[model samples]
Target: MNALTLASASVKSRPLHATLCVLAAGAGIALLCAIFLLSGAVERSFIRNAQGIDVVVGAKGSPLQLVLSTVYAADVPNGNIEADQAKRIEHDPRVAKAIPLALGDNHNGYRIVGTTPDYLSLYDASFAQGKVFEKPFDAVAGALTHLKTGDSFLGAHGLAADSDDIHHYHAYTITGVLKPTGTVLDRLILTQVESVQQLHAHPDLGDPDAAEDLKISHEVTALLLKMKSPLSIMSMPRQLNKTSNMLAANPGYEMARFSRSMGFGKEVLTALGAGFVALSALMLLSALASSLAARRYDLGVLRVLGASPFTLSCTVIAEGMMLSLAGAVFGILAGHGMAYLVAVNIDSLQGLVLPQSFLHFGALDGALLGMGAVTGLVAGLVPAVSAARTDIAGILARGRA
Candidate 1:
């Protein structure tokens, strides 16, 4: 018989042992794959959010908190800064662009950001319907907001749909709706800074045209600043912290430190997974060694049928590799399935959107299959060598005696 037929027969003869090796290796690969997918997605999201904005200037607080709040919109602001203070930074020679973030009100849990039209340029946003906010109380909805241009919604006092403080007096008109950009902006409600000032100043609204005279405090929650040059980071951050009362944070640095802090647990899990893979190799070796003892007579008969020593050795090795291939394939599928479920739940509750690449496996996954095959080949080596040296003539003579 050919080597393929021999290898198939060997695995078919011992199903339980084969399954044990596959399951162990599969579990290890599954955990690793899931980690790879999740980490890549998270890193990409952070990097994308921090693009263009070099410095985050806000009231003195946790630097990490400032970065998270301004960049990711996942945290509360660190107190407000004077509108004049932010404008001073905007006109500074070292600053390229400055977008003031005025955050407070929300509609049905979606945050309403009070900023100028320049904020839309940060995400390269284009209107899918209508134009930008032209008048007070006029709003531009995100693509995911499910609101059309003419639709009007009451703004909640806080960032919660179920918030107790609801502004029943005023209804904000959606003058525009942004196209889906796959960024955090897809979940926000954008309106003129004047609209937010009006929302807080007047609780009881009358007419849109008549309310233009009302005024509120000139304060912003934070400032997103971009530098004119790479060299500006060193002097500007220090100056902002030392000379000014506000805090400045570098998102890239904060994110790396945060990732390092979170990495300890992931490293431990990886070590455990490696332990399982090693155990799988051991089990495969033992199973192959044990099988050789019982299969010597069959192997000798094959040798008598004109199969060479090398062919017999390769057959045993192929059987082990086949088991590895099965395990690797199973592990990859299981890992991605878990990631998909997780991404779905996160999107449903949290506004963080994972990219299309997160759901797809790349070259590393294919490399895992090859790695598994190598593992099996190493485990089956000693047993294959023993099988190749089987005494054909002696076994036949003894059986006939």
Candidate 2:
């Protein structure tokens, strides 16, 4: 019989042992696959969303929190800074662009970022529908916003446009819906910074009674600054902190900090996966060793019929290879399916989209499969060698004893 037929017969003859080997090998591979998929997806999402902007200027607090708040809209602002201070940074020779961020309002749980047209330019973004806000009360929605055509955002004060409501307010028109950037920007309701000031300042603006009593303080949550060169990156932050109450933090640095803090758990998962693979190899070795004992009489009949010791060893090794191949095949399919399901759910809730290429089982996957096969091959070697060294006379004597 051919090697394939022999291996199939061997597996079919010992169904329980074969099934145990398959499950052991598959479990190791499944965990490894999950680690690869999750890590790749998160890394790609972070890289894509964090491109362009170099420095974040905000009130003194946690640098990581400032990065998360400004870049992802994932947190509330630390504190407010003077808009004039932000504008000064804008006009600085070393500064390329500065985008103002005003916070304090939320449509449901999502934060609203009030910034200028420069903010959209920073992302190089475009609308999937409608246009940018043109007037004071107008607003633009992100891709994930549930607002539809002709929907209006009523101010917190319960007043709408062209109305004489008790409290002063403005009606924000839903002019545009941005295409999903797979970034935190996808979750924001963006409007001009001046517009937000106007909304909050409305009570004092037209009323002489309120205007005389108004002690106004126009402030912003943070500022996104792009530098002209790498040199300014070092000097600007130092100057800003020494010169003003605001602190400058590098997004890239804070992102690294956040990733390092988060990545420790993922590394632990990887170590656990590696341990499983090693344990799987050991289990396969034991299974082969045990099976050889039960098949001693059959092996003896084959040897008497002229099968060499080498041939017996080859048969045992072939069994190991067959099990590895079957496990790898099933593991790969299961891994890919799991990745697809995870990606779909994450895209729905987090807007962190992953491309098809991210989950491909290309070179890295092939290397893992090869390692599994090698592990299986090694697992059979000791058992195969022992089986070949077995003496038929001694076996018969032991049976009689």
Candidate 3:
């Protein structure tokens, strides 16, 4: 038989052991691939949420929290910046646009954001149904929002899926639903800033200056700032922190800081994954070496039947490659399937949407698959050498004995 046929028969002879070797390698690859997909998705989510904003202006607090809340809608707002402060920033020569956000209250777990229609452009979002909110109590829903256009519901006091304190008296009607952008906006409820202000307004509620200009009485959770020039990054945030009551946070800088803190743990996990891969490679080597020992007599017979020593070596190597191929393919599928399952479950329970980012194979994935082949090559090398150098006379004599 040819080398490939011989290799196939040899592997088939020990199907259970071959499968075990593949599974060991596959398990390591699955862990590594899943981690990569999750990390990549999270990083992309952060970047997408921060797109087009040069700085975030909010109350003095954790800059990361402010960005996470205002940008990603994943946390509570630190505090509010006055309406006049947001307006002043809007008028700054260096500022191109300042999209204000007023948050608090949720419709079945989705955050209700009070912002102008300009907010849609920040994400390059388009209308999937109906139109933008034009008046108080009118809402433009996110793609994932439970409410459809023309539907109405009273929002709860806090951003909880089920909160006890409901705004039972007045109802907000959904005016539009945004096309899914896969950003924070995908799950948020958008309305005019007035709608948010009205929700907080009551005869008994306290305010520092309740009688102030009704417009000035409004307060926003944050300002999504755009600059006229890239150079403004240096001056804008510094000026805001020094002169204004609001704190200015650079989302890019904050994300980088977050990445640094997360990087060490990421490295540790990666090293652990590499270790597993190495261990599996060793297992494959050991299994193949033992198989080669058992098959010495059979391979010697093939040598007598006109098969070259090179053919025997190649046959053993082919067996190793077949194992690696099976492992790599299975591992890739398992990793993505795990990601898909997590995404669906997370959306159903917590509403934190994690898309199947692993489905898109990139250089990282290619390298991961390549690593399997390299492992096979390393594992197969010693066995192939031994097969090439096998003592045909000795094996045959021992077999006859």
Best by TM-score: 3
Error of 3 at 151 (Å): 1.5
lDDT values of the candidates? 0.79, 0.73, 0.82
lDDT of 2 by residue, 213-246 (tens): 1222277778888899998888898888788788
- Residue 302 CA displacement from its true place in model 1, Å: 2.4
Tens-digit lDDT string for candidate 1 (129-214): 99999887889998777789999988876566687566665689999999877667878898877777767666654534223223
- Which model, 2 or 3, shows the larger lDDT? 3
- In the range 158-264, model 3's lDDT, one tens digit per residue, is 67888866765468998888877777788899988888787666412354333432332278889999999988976899888898778999999998998899889
lDDT score for residue 191 of model 1: 87
Worst 10 residues of 1 by lDDT: 207-216
Q: How much is 76 displaced in model 3, in angstroms? A: 1.4
Report the backbone clash tally of model 3: 0
| Every model's TM-score | 0.87, 0.80, 0.92
> Model 1, stretches more than 4 Å misplaced?
12-20, 124-134, 142-150, 175-182, 204-216, 347-356, 393-401
Cα-lDDT of candidate 2:
0.73
Of the two candidates 1 and 3, the one with more favorable lDDT, higher being better, is: 3
